[model samples]
Target: MRYEKIKTLSELKNIIKGLRAKNKRIVFTNGCFELLHAGHASYLQKARAMGDILVVGLNSDSSVRKIKGGPRPVTKEKDRAKVLSLLWCVDFITIFSSTTPFNLLKAVRPDVLVKGGDWKVKDIVGSDLVTSYGGKVKSLPYLKGYSTTGLIKKINLLTPRRCAVRTYAAGKKGNTL
Candidate 1:
């Protein structure tokens, strides 16, 4: 019933400080999370398994559009954060407007930083920062054939025709129904 997991940068800083004092292993991961799919759920669960708490850096709507181009982030930032807050694996969620989570990661100073295998270790934002602080960095593989782009394509294919055709390829009349 509580949605306190979604916090602002300042609030998260305080929370992280307390968690660290308690010696909780914090794991951090960030993404646009445009569409909450099974792949995301699975990835978060696996990331959480590597530590005691999982903190997600949610990309803001404008950031998503800048990074992912137009027609992105079908869901709003607050909505995405709200949905992520529902996941048991997600201990905290913070909306960041930056294209990369470097600043947020610096603030979190998590015990672990994780990204999908699709990203190379050198390319992962904040990988070096985590490692510099003696934290672990991991690239977990994404679920096969479970991506937002693919889902959108499948949905487009299933959409019914808006206009009716009265003829077939052989010049034969066909029923609109």
Candidate 2:
């Protein structure tokens, strides 16, 4: 499936309204999605099941760095978006630099909002927005041991941490990270 891109608020708002008119239910999901994993695929697939179209709000590179800290976002935003775009479940992709997807949510006002079960419904950023618009929010259970953080951490384990191995104080004899 081809991926539609949402660049500006106006375009997103129009897209939602247009799709809605065609009796299409849109499902909205947002996250850093730093490193795609089984959990991500499962969550996305479930989100897709909730609506006729799945619009994913991906964090911009800077936003990912800000939320995840430096050395994060193993993949660049473009590459990440491209990867998701190729997925059969994702119909549209929007890259946002905001910490929360509030603005994007308000603009899209999707028929359904989906997130992993780890987050409480009330804790979700756009839950209220969707609810206000008579939309629904659903959470899908995550796959065990499948997470972007866990994936990155596992990769980190394979690659040793860089260190200077400096002598601590003069008499210290233990090496530490």
Candidate 3:
């Protein structure tokens, strides 16, 4: 089940240790993932292809608010994690409340650290730490025209305006309906 894929940091650390012992390559990626989309799935699948396991570090609700400001993360952290857990390409998920995944990266010490093409390898957090340990850091290509913000804007545009609501109410003649 999807719930089984969610793990605490300590639990994930132990699991990573075991996987490493088995010579499994671990790939790590971090994101808010406020809303799952085709782009997210494609990127995750590509990241997983680079290693045996894919560990996604999800930003907590508060962390998302800090980075994206208010009214963001359309979904809560737990919900976001649950959604990511359902993806076949994602092996495990760990929620992090920090502004960045630098600490989480230290814990997992993934064989490969990846971010979207929007981020340069040198600018990606934990790039140095991962590279210092002989681990590879990658910048995956970012899919165009697919983003939570864009989706939200589209939804907003499709919604009826307040003037339309007022017109409908006037037609009701004070009826409860």
Candidate with maximal TM-score? 3
lDDT by residue (tens digit), candidate 3, 1-177 = 449999999999999999999999999999999989999999999999999999999999999999999788789999999999888999999999999999999999999999999899999999999999999999999799898888888777864443243334656653332
Model 1 worst lDDT run, 10 consecutive residues:
159-168
TM-score of each: 0.88, 0.83, 0.89
Q: After superposition on all CA atoms, what RMSD does each candidate show versus the true structure?
A: 6.6, 7.9, 4.0
* Residue 141 in model 3: lDDT: 90
- Provide the clash count, candidate 3: 0
Query: Which residue pairs in model 1 clash with each other?
Result: none
Task: Report the candidate with higher lDDT, 2 versus 3.
Answer: 3
Candidate 1 Cα misplacement greater than 4 A, ranges: 160-177
- Candidate 1 TM-score, C-alpha based: 0.88
